[model samples]
Target: MSDRPKTPTLDRVHLPSDLKALSDAELHRVADELRAETISAVSETGGHLGAGLGVVELTVAIHSVFDTPRDRLIWDVSHQCYPHKILTGRRDRIRTLRQKDGLSGFTKRSESPYDPFGAAHSSTSISAALGFAMARELGGAPDPALGDAIAVIGDGAMSAGMAYEAMNNAGHLGKRLIVILNDNEMSIAPPVGAMSSYLSRLYAEGPFQELKAAAKGAVSLLPPPFQEGARRAKEMLKGMAVGGTLFEELGFSYIGPLDGHDLDQLLSVLRTVKARATGPILIHAVTKKGKGYGPAEQAADRGHGVSKFDMITGEQKKAPSNAPSYTKVFAQSLTEEAERDDRVVAVTAAMPDGTGLDLFAERFPRRCFDVGIAEQHGVTFAAGLAAGGMKPFAAIYSTFLQRGYDQVVHDVAIQRLPVRFAIDRAGLVGADGATHAGSYDIAYLSNLPGFTVMAAADEAELKHMVATAVAHDAGPIAFRFPRGEGVGVEMPERGEVLEIGKGRVVREGSGVAILSFGARLKEVMEAVEALGARGISPTVADARFAKPLDRELILRLAAEHEALITIEEGAVGGFGSHVAQLLAEEGVFDSGLKYRSMTLPDIFIDQASPGDMYAVAGLNAGDIEAKVLQALGVERLESRRA
Candidate 1:
């Protein structure tokens, strides 16, 4: 903060309205200052630095050319909205990005009018923007007005089929929509899929570029001086049967493969499009992911997501962890399993690094698959692999797994394809917020018939679950683990396969029992210690599998204990709900047993530290203690603190 850079041109603008007052030259200066400001701000609050740096000029140009808030500007994924936040009215709070109760890392509709559509997930902006565009034609939101709808999507986002679906519908509806494809040749990882290859070829060679334009057949849309020559060129290409660009064939005007970093080009094209666009239009702009930032540009992944770092040396100030990250543990366990079983393979949906499957890919290149951003395809593909006698572990984030639920249910669960699911980020993720939180996987997966759902209490348990999944081929089985480092514990030489639907007594006590699931066992132990101070020793048990409930152990606990509490880092209708159903069915509730379930509250948590988010969810140690105390009918002074 002491070395906060001065933003001269950016300092003058409070909002997009102020941007309109500046000359084109001044706007260029603004873009420069904006980049400085973005780097400085993200240096202090590290989150999605490269993407924001990539979109500085585009953000400035769009704001300068279009009347935003009213025009409904939607950013696909919205991770690059940091520059937009600064250009809009939130510049003052730029440094507070992704902190507790601070500005969110992603766009939230309620946070500002500028973010008309909230998005942290990718490829959704086009669909949302098209909705706004169609709404304008059909008398959408405003009392007397409906303006233009523009979506600035990434080249990576284009890989998703959802983008095409929206474009197809937008083409059919024929609304005046503007779609900016920010082609940086990268997403979180390197871009893949047909769309990326097509975009890459669009700018690779001279003949390809010229032929691409001719293929688009946009002669009249060309400049006046080149129109006649372009028309002759287009006629030749038409005879060659390279009719038009994919976008043009889909009923939208295709423009560019333009220079996104050049303010002059971006501003000129935006203004021209604003003035003349009729139906849907695609503006392809090529730019570097970490533009104007030396450290970010040099780093692998283009410093996509970062930790708070030094401005001079881009050295991240990440705190040291006591143990390997849960992601790393999963990778290690899976690698060992793969070594044992040649039939084992890994599949990830665009998150090879994040899921730690990149390591697996290194060890077993032929066995690992990176499916790009297509989760649905990845899920079904894994199912097909399983059907072909391969033990395919689909390693995907819990939040992202929601996208492939239909495939998971239909192709895997219903068919009992035995596609093992390695669900990462199974609880409230800190800075990435609720959009990325793995809060509902337990509920969603457990409810599926013939599906086995397990939660890891610690790193050792995760290894066992990985082994258990490898051994099981009865049906679709899944195990969820939270983000961040595991609680430090002794490393096991190899994972032992555990019996399905079993519970293990971690600590035995008398009056009350706490059935903990997932990584909440650490907090449960802390809660037990706190309760111990009050002379209220409680029994703690780890309920490994939620789908096949441990009826004997749970019923025994219910019958013996005065009260039993279930705690999990998931929503309602998860392990707790299943236990409740089991208790009611077994007539355990008839004995007047006090039962309580501690789960995440019915609300989306905002970006914050993991501790702060857990506090908000009322699932922290103190909250767990209160639930335990309340269940046992103990009148405690500390309950007020919780």
Candidate 2:
């Protein structure tokens, strides 16, 4: 074997087919190379470093053992697919990972054939893998051969109900499948669940390999019909002792609690499992996040995802910020509210720091709860808190809120529980891209009965919205804000509660009015300034609430202005859609009113700088001004000075 590191070899093989040609020893070398390449790529691009590093060996082993593109391998959440991407004809583009027009931060179906199923959110892989397995059985693939279907999921993702639902179904159906449990005992933060605790105990015990061997030996000793009966009995005994009391009970053949980083062990066990696995099989592989990198491993959050950093020093190169982020503002505001009112409490779904709930947690530890990545549980838990006369703020990211949509409708909205949803990252997230984008909350939340949805136009507005959520005790209320630092706008000394369903006109103008919603107000202001230089002064109003929509103010603006434009930082069905529905009901669009709705285009935008993504979505000031001028039928040259 060459003394040089295997990553250099990995740099040469850009496709899965290339990996297939390599010998077993060469494949082991490729695994090390893949790890180094992944570490280097993430170190440069600043994305899900820890999770991706944890699965490097697993990625190589799976690709080496299975005929990928023919046999689908679905990675749960896909945050750990950097190594997988490197091996699948994407190594050349690794440097451009998360850059504009470059590789996606998560697995994208559009990006490559190797990504059989795309995922950004957690708990999706098992269901998707099962679907692929069923589809293969239904004659979707070129050959009728039962294509291998595997799902590599983390112990953290297993906390969510969907994974269990998929496992239950897969077990019952007795489908030929592989579910590799990549247990690192962390998920952005240390995972929380009875299941997580159970896995941790199993990891400590190290009984899986011994029990499996003993069971197999006993099966081989019996004869004929008695042998089959003994085999079944052995399975039951193994389930009772080790393999899986839970999974085997659900009807799957539980195989391991193996060491994920052990190349020989992983390859040997995988080769064996691949041969005789009749029903669904679960392989529990324990790994260490940030496995190969010392500095990353030492970091507080295990360098889960990072910004561009110094490779030698492991120090992040951060852009200096004048003001705190919207998350911080929300946390501070919520903490203040909790201090003032004993009923106030905060909850997050595995994102205390991201949601700015860390401050609240620090101040009032008992009142704060981090419910792992189970957004559905977080919502219902908040509802339970509310039902018990406690005010619970279900602080979750806008993208994650999608996981609890049913809970929001059934447990909170229908029952009219006062669960304050502090929806963070409420618009197009930049480097993390579309999967993490808070694009659908406005549309999804606004339409729910008894749901009061609001958008913060700025940091001060976010503070007020938090206060409003605290004060409002009637029903489920939510306020969304985008990702990034506040726009250096003046913050309030203390949060002041604002009236529900109200809007404030920021700048007064004639002929054309721009209705700004959420974090897009900064861009709206810039557009207004640009239009002023062009001698066309446009009115700008911040319509705070998406549901109870400041309708009278909107109608007044419509009556006074020659043209009206509705702009929001969400997808088609959100704030703009609500405005359109209101206007149509009021007959604003009946007379062919000069109108336009600005929203994110119906496309999964790739990773890029926030400004660049905004420009692409036409939410930037220049883009907004140009669209407004065009909508009003004004020539570009005529507006050179609107």
Question: Whole-model Cα lDDT per candidate?
Answer: 0.90, 0.85
What is the overall TM-score of model 2 with all chains considered together?
0.92
In the range 1-642, model 1's lDDT, one tens digit per residue, is 557877788889998999989999999899999999999999899999999999999999999889978898999888899999998899999888999878999999888999999998899988999889889988877763769899999988889989999999989988899999999999999987787777776676465456544434234457789878876775465335433468877887777667788787777678778888888999988989999989999998998999999889999999989999999999999999999899999999999999999999999999999888999999999999999999999999999999998999999999999999999999999999989999999999999999999999999999999999999999999999999999998879999999999979999999999999889999999988998999999999999989898999999999889999999999998999999999998888889999999999999898898999999999999999988877776765556656
Query: After TM-score superposition, what is the CA distance of residue 239 in candidate 2 from its true location, in Å?
Result: 7.6
Give me the runs in candidate 1 sitting further than 4 Å from their true place: 208-229, 232-244, 636-642
- Clashes by residue pair, model 2: 6-33, 7-33, 14-89, 531-642, 533-641, 534-641, 639-642
What is the alpha-carbon lDDT of model 2 when measured against the actual structure? Answer: 0.85
What does the lDDT come to for candidate 1? 0.90
Query: What local lDDT does model 2 show for residue 281?
Result: 86
Instruction: For candidate 2, write residues 62-150 as lDDT tens digits.
Output: 88888887789899988898888888888888878889999988898999988878898899898999998898778776663548899
